[model samples]
Target: MSLLRILVRVALVALLSMAPLSVAAHEVQPAISDVELSEDTVTITLTTAIEPILAGVDLEGIEDTNDSPLSDRVDALRALPPETLAAELAERWPEIAERITLRAGDTRVTPVLVDVTIPEVGDTEIRRDSTLLLTAPLPDDGSPVTFGWDAELGGLIVRQGDDAQGYNAFLTSGAVTDPMPRTGVAEQNLGDVIVTYVVSGFDHIIPKGLDHILFVLGLFFYSLAWRPLLWQVSAFTVAHTATLALATLGIVQPTMWIVEALIAASIVWVGVENIWSGGRRDIGWGRIAVVFGFGLLHGLGFASVLSEFGLGQYFIASLISFNVGVEIGQLTVIAAAFLLLGLPFGSKPWYRRAVAIPGSLVIAAIASYWVLNRIGWAGDIPYLA
Candidate 1:
């Protein structure tokens, strides 16, 4: 057998071995909630995929819902009709509400289910989200209230209504927002908001962002040399920072569907260029320009995620902090790549043929699958979809 064929077979086998892990990673989406406090009641509208939760799966700590032992149950729940799923949640409200907590002063308040909205059954390949409304009665004394969810429910986006200046923050499991009043809750302090958003931004990149990880790896594989890699990454950072700010400020609004498709396309472009360039030592202005343009598309993608956590007061701080965190994440990736490949073998002649080309091929293949899958053509192909 030819050397290239052998390498291809080895890559395929490695991917197959990691298939279960990949599926699990892709299935988990963080739970997001919008909180509204009024004189009489505190309402939380949570949008999440309820199938795994209903299937007796413990989503806490698991990267993918499928990684749970309750995969069979999750599949069963997915097969259920929207009405049926809603009914099941209604019947299990007591159990479900226990995982979500709302408190007034020192007392834990039990929430009554206001409504449940589930998407109609569609292709099993697409995960459907259900909107849940839970309301808790406020204390007549007008005492401050705290809101949060169990660690098992994942992260929550806590936002306040009734305040002209809007209050919002992203909270991880077990983290509670500052005590909010029935009216006019103060915005979080600038330093605290900056720190909190920095953590949020870092969290999104290190573990949750597989696509972004692959894209960064594509850049690294282009050339492990410091000059070329730094140039590309710098251009990327500037471009993404621009779009992220613009999109968050609501000046440039684009549909997430388009942004996602473009993001995938960007990955393909980087990977293809790596192969075409053959790990050239010199960096070109054209490549830097391309990276900058792709960075804009990726910034839009980042904006989509940040949009879920409404930019409350301290908008500039939050925006800059998030951008700083993303840069940190990118640098971390580059550092790891250097440790693994560049440190020892970067100067070797075979490094380009053995590492850069093969890695780029794999990246290009995965990204091509993403492009097709994003456009809805892959259809139930486990890895591709």
Candidate 2:
């Protein structure tokens, strides 16, 4: 076989492997748990997609539960009646509780399953959330408590109720939060808050966010030349930062469906532009302006993710940290592109034809499909359906 054909075959296999990752990106939803500490009892209300967890699908680092080998079992569980599902969860509570830990001071507190609320069978296409209530008795002395799940359960959004300050955080993989009783203990300093949020933001872009990665790749392929790339990236960063702050502050509230559709459209636009521009160094101001506008849409998309873990006590810290992390992630993508493609072959005569054009075309095609899928035409495609 010709070298080009061999390379194409390998690329096709890689893309197919990444296809599940893309689907999983859109299905990313963290489980939320509301922890309320009362005088006598500690009540934890967790709202999560139960079927996947019950099916032994690892929620952490998984893009989509449907892509799991155990998806068939999850589907069967999803089809069960509410009562039956509740009963199954009841039977499974002991094992599940063992994986989740709650501690009052130095001593472990055992949580008893109080109630389970299962959603009625809805559109099987969408995973439905179920609520689980587990309670543990509070110590008479009223000491501080720490609670977290096993790393295997994935990330959990813990919201603190019954406190005036209302502290909340998105914890991942066995990471526990500061002590819960907010009165005596010191709150997280600004540095701690910043570090936590920064990691969250970077994770969203680097490994977890396939759509965002494609968008960044679209910008990267537009031009490897420093001047144009810097302008476009700076504009995008500034624009998204502005909108991310606004959306997080609740000033600009746009529906996610609209933001997501526009984000996909932005990817398609950039990819198509790269092809049309033909590796030109003279990218116009108009293109930069469009990029900035699309950056605003992308910011709203970022806001949707941040909304999952509401700005707790440290709103400014979290917002700024997350945006900084996103910028870092974006720069990392550009740097990787540079090292991989531009460093070696950017000056080559056939760089445009061999790399730029083909890459942009592929990005455009995938993003166009994403646009259609996000806008509800996914069911029309046989494989996607």
Candidate 3:
């Protein structure tokens, strides 16, 4: 544990120096990702990283495919009118509606795709696997053009063309998510969103994330003693577990803005407390109480996650398992922290000042900075390419 703690400390110092804010944001969502497509088809394909919640159901192109060449796609598209091309593809795959049109202020579009993929998991991509042979006359409009007439699809319609970089341009990395709810769970096409939400949400509360990791570390930093450390961990477990259940079950809610603010605040509290205080403060149960309170806020945050998912089929099992999963992930983090710092302390008096104090201060500083940035009080934190 002591040696691992040393390595963790070393890594944190190195990463923070390289690109603290940008790397931190990337922990939640990639700022920008690339996708590749052929130059001919009005169809789109995605090649990028997406949070796991989108892996299922949210397809970018076709669900299955072949090593079809880009040229094959181009030649097929050029030979057919746009309507015939859309209809034939719809006949084969069926995800696309025959006619979809909408006005977005001035822009209107219709969508057609040859395939879809979630590359973040395993370099997934959907390519144009076959040609769309239409027995109708081609429109001489010069490009894959869309009309101003309204039609059916998503609330709006759009497509890929030359101005979009190419006829075979990289489409958006986002999957077709359900409409955002105005109040309770909004009805969503949960072909896979449910499982994805649970899995990725679990992953989010783990290693690649520095802020929450630091918060978990803060929970352990105060105890240079074995018994107190045990008690604190137990209390934290109970509190987080209670809230995770309440939130997942839809028993609570906190505005998205406040939940993030408090998360930042929780980190600050643990870090600052670790630095200045130690060895059995007069208020013995104070830390436990504070953690319990923060756990409530975290629970509300958790509920929002499940609520947004809009899936009710596996509610009971998913709620329980997801809560258990969160606890396991949290404990794993604390275990790693102990391996790094615990053995070195071994109930030593000086260990508090030398390691715990300094470490806690650093964590607090980072959390406080996050709070400032989130509230828009500071300039946008510089991110990486």
In terms of lDDT, the best-performing candidate is: 2
Point to the candidate with the largest TM-score: 1
Model-by-model lDDT, in order?
0.77, 0.79, 0.46
TM-scores, one per candidate: 0.91, 0.89, 0.52
Which pairs in model 1 have colliding backbones? 24-64
lDDT per residue as tens, model 1, 283-316: 9999999999999998998888788777777677
Which of candidates 1 and 2 reaches a greater TM-score? 1
- For each candidate, how many residue pairs have backbone atoms clashing (under 3 Å)? 1, 1, 12
Task: Provide the lowest-lDDT 10-residue window in model 2.
Answer: 15-24
Model 1 CA deviation exceeding 4 Å by range:
1-26, 162-164, 380-385
Cα lDDT of candidate 2 equals 0.79
Q: Kindly provide the TM-score of model 3 when superposed on the true structure, using C-alpha atoms.
A: 0.52
lDDT of 1: 0.77
Clashes of 3: 12
Ranking by TM-score: 1, 2, 3
**Candidate 3, poorest ten consecutive residues by summed lDDT:** 148-157
Of 1 and 3, the candidate ahead on TM-score is: 1
